[model samples]
Target chain A: MPGIEDLYREIILDHYRTPRNRGELPPPAVYSEGNNPLCGDDIRIYLDVADGVVRDVKFSGQGCSISQSSTSMMTVAVKGKTVAEVQAFVRRFKHMMTLTNESETVDESVKLGDIEALQGVVKFPVRIKCATLGWNTLLEALTEAIK
Target chain B: MVTTLTEASHNMSFDSAVIRRDFPLLAKQIDGKPLVYLDSANTSQKPNAVIDAMANFMRESYAPINRSAYTLAANATEQYEGARAAVAKFINAKSAREIVFTKNATEALNLIVSSWGRANLKTGDVVLLTHMEHHANIVPWQMLQQERGIELRWVPLTSDFQLDLTSLTSLLSGVKVFSFTSMSNVLGTINPVEKLCAAAHAAGAISIVDACQSVPHSPSDVQSWGADFATFSGHKMCGPSGVGVLWGREELLEAMPPFLGGGNMITDVRLDGFTCAELPAKFEAGTPPIAEVVGLGAAVEYLTNIGMANVRQHEISLSSYVLDLLTNRFGDDITIHGPRNPELRGATFSFAFRGIHPHDISQILDQSNVCVRAGHHCAKPLMKIIGANATTRASFYLYNTTTDADTLADALDSASDIF
Candidate 1:
């Protein structure tokens, strides 16, 4: 059995307590919301994208440590990255969260940084949705920004 | 014999320690920790008697009921009907024929909304509901409103979490049907069913009580409540899943059309049309959950032996212990979203702790084998009213003791430390 320590690492708790880029961006920033109806974990991602790059990003939501921390981490991870880079990073982040036997061989081209702390969330299958709620909302916001 | 046993147990002081021994799951250990199950509001842990009854029935007298004329089939039918009779007696219903078996309480509520709501209600017809109702009671009515253009009105809550009945008269003015939960599944507020039903009747409307949360924990009398329809799930009362009871006034059941059409729900059939079966059978429709019903019978018998009055007494005491422990220890840091009085609520406690998310709290508690439900608890409207996206709910039952309550408090301490 995976212990609680694995799921709630110090890095994760730190990120949850003092989140980075934790405010909403006003319009002309593309915005999207994601929620887990089961646990009532809601996430909203705001993105300011220009010239195929995410110029700025912020997140505002209320959820468990995994979700809120992931959202906070997500804003920092994608803030200065191009749309393509952020999209690829989202795929890799989600890949880490997936329950695949081949998860050990995740593409290491992009550094996951603090987001890798959420890799432990996959052990608790139910919290996987929590750890990914931010990224999913980010993807939605990215789609809206590009369009 | 059952009445004598129930009365005898009621006089004696309720002993949860002795009662805990009856449920095999309470003895279970996870990760070197004894399981402190406090999610009975979700689904109860079945006693050994229910488990054995179901297993023994399947092993000894397993046969399809009501179809074959064979001796085995006859005996199976007897046991199946016997379960229905037990459920009727448990709830103090007028007759077993008034109890219609369904998949679960959701299906039971759906049966009422789709069958009775459709036949009785028209466009612009009003169905008054309470704010604390489970989604089962709310969503079906909403569906009816969408399809038939019926109006849905809600009875809001007071500042202290109890139902605000001050405007119930005006709310029921134009209501053709008034449906509400006998107890709030989230807040643990026990509604005045008899009073609500009387108010509904005074306004010339029928009452449907979602007794899912109340029936298992307390004494239920459909006749006394003066309700037209009442529904509850067996699994929430130490019974197995896949079986639920919908007790209705016989006349109304007789008048309404069958919800499902298949074997066992009809008497005579033709290519053109079919005649529906009488009372309960008309609504049962399919080959019922025979073994689960038998298990439910055992569960009803177990509760009857212990007496629901005693069960309610145990919960009251436990609720008081939990309330004092959580509030006194946490102080302003913890916010329990229910009536402070034990008499006003069940042992179910939906609380917010130190700004910690309910999911995180429950997750940390799970490390200590303290099982609790964390979410909207299928009462989203009440969640919104309480100003929480979700709340951590720890619900107790007849088998739980004050020690379990203490364990929960200690676990909350650890959760705060982690967060």
Candidate 2:
């Protein structure tokens, strides 16, 4: 059995308490909102993509530690990466959170880093939505930006 | 404005410890700790009586009902219809024919909006609903609005979380159907059913009561409420899932078209068309949930034995204890939504703690085996009104005791420690 500490890791709490890239991006940025209707967790992701490079990314929302922290870590991870790289990272992060089988292998190059702390969330199936709300919104914003 | 725990307990009619023993799940241990279930508003824990009744029916008399004439089939049909009679008597309906069995309360509400609403409401007709209704009550109306071009009116809430009835007459003025919940599933605010029903009647609108929250927790009489139709789920009332009751006025049910078109709903099916069956059967299409209804019958009997007055009293005392303990312990750190007076509310408590999110609070509470719900509780509009995105809810039933409240408080301390 996993303890409460496992779900709310120290880094996750730190990110939740003092989030990075917490505000909106400037104009010319594409934005999208995602909501976990059951938990009332709503997040809006803002993206600034210029010439295929991810120039800036920010998020603003109210959610639990997992979601807020995951979003904070996601912004830090994807700020300097290219649009294609961030898209791959999003897929990798979702895969890590929803680890369908223990035997399934994760690509080592798409490093999750601090976001890997949220792997414990897979145990609590209900909180997986909380952990992924920000990432899903980020994905939507990226899609909107390319369009 | 706070009642003492001693006074509250003294006023209660039954001992919760004794009632707790009737439910086997109350004895369950989670993570090596005794389970403290406080999510009765979501769904109640079933007692041994209901479990045994369902099991017994399956073993002794389970058969396809209302379609066969064999002795065994007749016996099964008798038991199934007997559940309908129990439901009818439970809600004080005029006749058993008024009770229509659907999959659950959601389906029951959908049945009304599709069947009765479609027949009566035309384009531009108004249907009034409250801000605090569950999605079951709201979505059905919204579906009708889009498909039939009907309009929806909302009755807002007061600052104290009760329904703001000052403009109710104006809200109901052009309304063809006035649908609302008897008690809020999240806020626990008990609405004035009879008064609202009268207002709806005076305005020439039919009243529909979503009694899913009220029927299980308190004494409910549809006739006394004067509601044209009332619906509730057996699962929320200590029975099994897959069965719910929709009690409509006999005349209205007869007048409306059937919601579903299938086997048992029709009396005669020719090559070209079909004639619908009688009142209850017309709404009850295809194979009904026979054994679940038997369990619901047993659930009603079990609740009757405990006495609804006593059940309501138990919850009142429990609610008082929860409010007193949580406030006294957490002080300004805690914020409980809804009326402070126990008389004005049910046992449901949706609250926030410090700055910790509801999911975190619920997670910490689960460590001590205290089960609570943390979400919008299917009332997004009400959540918006209350100024909370989500709230951690701990709802009590007749089986809950002050010890459960203590466990919940102790668990909260752990949550605060984590945050």
Candidate 3:
């Protein structure tokens, strides 16, 4: 059985206590919001994209430590990456959290950085939605930006 | 021999050990620790009596009811109808024909909305509901408002979370239907049913009570409440799932159109139209939950033996103990989201502890084998009104003891140490 410590690691707690890139972006920023109404976890993703690359990204939400800290880590990871790179990162991060395939192993190619700490969220089926709310909202913002 | 209510009420004392023994799940352990269940408001743990009643019925006389005329089918039909009579007597309805068995309390409430609201309500008519109603009560009316262009009025809450009836008259003005919960599933505040019903009558509106939370934990008399319709589920009352009771006035049930049309609900089916059946059968559209109804009947008998007044007294004492313990121990660190008076509320306590998320608190409590519910509790509007995303709810029933409260407090202390 996975313990609570596994779900709330020290690094995750640090990110939650002092979140990074938490605020609004200027005009022409790509923005989208997502919320898990069941848990009352809400996330608004704001991104500044220039030249097919994320110039800046920020997230603000009120939720459990898992959701807020994961958003903080996600913002740090995808800030300067290209839109394609961020999309790939989102896919890999979601794969790591879901691990839905039987024959699929963890792909070592995708360097997850601080977001890897959230892999333990797979153990908690309910909180997986909380941890992924920010990433899902970011993808939506990216799509809106492209449109 | 069945104990009379007077005899049962005379001995108002509760024996938690004896009551706890009735439920076998209470004796189980989780993670090597004894189970400390405090989530009765969500759904109750079934006693052996209910389980055996269902199992024995299924084994001996389980057959399709209301269709076949064989001896076995007759026995099953008798058992099923007997359950309805038991429910009618349980809530003191005028006749058993007023009680219609549905899938669950949600379905029961939906039956009222779809049958009565669709038939009687037209565009621009107003329906009054309380802010503290569970989604079951709120969503059905909202569905009607969207489809039929009806207006919805809300009875707001006082600062302390009770219904603010200061604007009761204005809110009830021109309302065609007044529907509300008898108790708040999230706040545990018991509404003044009699007064609310009288107000609805005074405003010339039909009164409906969502007695889901109240019916199980305390005595429920739709006649005494003077509500035209009331609903509750068997699963919440120490019975099996897939069975619920909808008790409506005979005249209203006779007048309303059928909510669902199928095998058992119609009197005659033609190419163009259909004539509906009588009161209870008109609402019961299909093959009903026969075994579950037997279990519900046994649950009613069990609660009658225990006496609802005694159950309420037991809960009052338990709530007082819990309030004193949690407050005196944690002080301002804990914020219980209900009226402080035990008499004003049921034993449900939705609280925020030391700024910890309710999910985190529930997870920590789970480690100590302390079961609680964490989330919006299907009452998102109430959660939003209370200004919280979610809350950790710990509710009690007759089987709970002061020891369970102590276990919960200790578990909370453990949670705080980590958070």
Candidate 4:
């Protein structure tokens, strides 16, 4: 039984309070919207991809701390990485989120960094969608950028 | 035993502690903390009478209803139809024939839209709805709109979250049907059903009241309300799930086409077409939720024994307590999104606390075993009107006490500390 402290860690709250890349991007940037209709969590991911390398990322959304902070953390983690690298990171982050038990270990190859704080979300299955809303939107944005 | 409990409740002043004892789940503890359930508007915890009735029916009298000629089947049919009678009496319908059992209130509303809306409404026909209706009421009409090209009109809300009916007559102009909730599930604002129904009648539009929220907490008289049709769910009224009631005027029900086609809904089937069954059976298409219906009957009996007036009185006091407690304690931090007056509302309250998102608030509240609902509450149009993506809703019921409200305030204090 993980407590509220585990889910709303200080790091997650900090990211929620002061989000990173919290604005929209101009033309030449691909964007995709993601919505969790169940909870009314809406996220729009704006991506600036150049020659297979992710140049920049930004997110704008209104949702709970888990969702908004995850979006903020997502923007920071995926920026300045290759598109493939970002894709790998998303897979790892989702894998951590889908883990039923908090004790479950992730693959040693991919490091989640601050996004690992959201692993506590797996304990609260309903909030897992909130934590992954941004990552799913990023996936959609990446799919659009590749096209 | 049930009778004694009911008599005790009726004889004594409204006591939530005594009422809470009837519901088994209220006794449950999470992480050594007592369960403070404030989400009765979502679905109520079933009382022992309803639970036992359902279980007893399944154990002894479980059989095919209205199909077999066996003694057991007759008994089962009697119980099922008895439930319909109970529901009819509960809402003061003219006859049990006016009541049609469906899967849930959503299904009941959909049945009306598909059957009556399709039969009566033509292209450009307008259906006036309120901003407070749940998706069940709205989406069915929308689906009809998409298919039939009918126009949809909305009755907006006042600043105080009540229906702004100042221009209702003008809005009711050219409207074929006026469908709205008797009580707003999100805002807890009680709509004036009798006034709305009369206005619809004067405008030559039939009124349909979604009484899902109002019926459970308060005494409902559809006849006095003069609503052409009314629908509600059993689950929200301390009965089992998988059952809902749709009560319509007998004449209107007779005129409408059947929504679902099956064995029970038909009188006789030929090679080309089939003759629909009479009145209620026309709408009841298949083997209905027999046990759940029995449980619903028990629930109705339980409420009747205790008296709906007492239930309403208890809720009114609870609402006043919660409204004052939350407002006075939280002050500028809490924003309760409903009318400040407790007399004009049910106990259901949707609120936003200190800019903290509803999901986070509910999550922290969950830590203290304080159950509440946090989301759009399936009223997205209302949510948009309120300028909130989502709101934390803590709905009280007859069984809820001021102690629960105090626990909610205490837990909210903890939420503020964490955030």
> DockQ for model 3?
0.67
- Each prediction's TM-score versus the true structure: 0.97, 0.96, 0.96, 0.97
DockQ-wise, the better of 2 and 3 is 2
Greater-lDDT candidate between 1 and 2:
1
Candidate 3: what lDDT?
A: 0.90
DockQ scores for all the models shown? Answer: 0.80, 0.84, 0.67, 0.79
Q: How much lDDT does each candidate structure score? A: 0.90, 0.90, 0.90, 0.91
Q: Model 1 chain B, poorest ten-residue lDDT window? A: B1-10
Which portions of model 1 miss their true places by more than 4 Å?
A99-106, B1-13
Worst 10 residues of 3 chain A by lDDT: A99-108
lDDT of 2 by residue, B1-419 (tens): 12345544654557889989999999988667898999999999999999999999999999999889899999999999998898888888989999999999999999999988888889999999999999999999999999999999999999899999999988899889999999999899999999999999999999999999999988888888999999999999999999988999999999999898999999999999999999889998889888999999999999887777777777787788888998899999999988888888899999989989999999889889899999999999888988999999999998899999999998999887888
Which residue pairs in model 1 clash with each other? Answer: none
Error of 3 at A48 (Å): 1.5
Q: Which candidate, 1 or 3, would have the higher DockQ against the true structure?
A: 1
Candidate 4: tens digits of C-alpha lDDT, residues A1-147: 577777988899999889999999997998999999988979999999999999989989798999999999999988899988888788788788763345654455989888888888888999989998898999999999999
Per-residue CA lDDT of model 2 for A52-113, tens digit only, reads: 88899989878988899999999999998888888778878878877435665556589888
> Per-prediction count of colliding residue pairs?
0, 0, 0, 0
Q: For candidate 1, write residues A93-144 as lDDT tens digits.
A: 9888874356454556988998888888988999998988888889998899
Model 2: per-residue Cα lDDT at residue B258: 89
| Better candidate number, 2 or 3, judged by TM-score | 3
Which stretches in model 2 have alpha-carbon errors above 4 Å?
A99-106, B1-13
Candidate 3, residue B91: how far the Cα is off, in Å: 0.3
| Second chain TM-score, each model | 0.97, 0.96, 0.97, 0.97
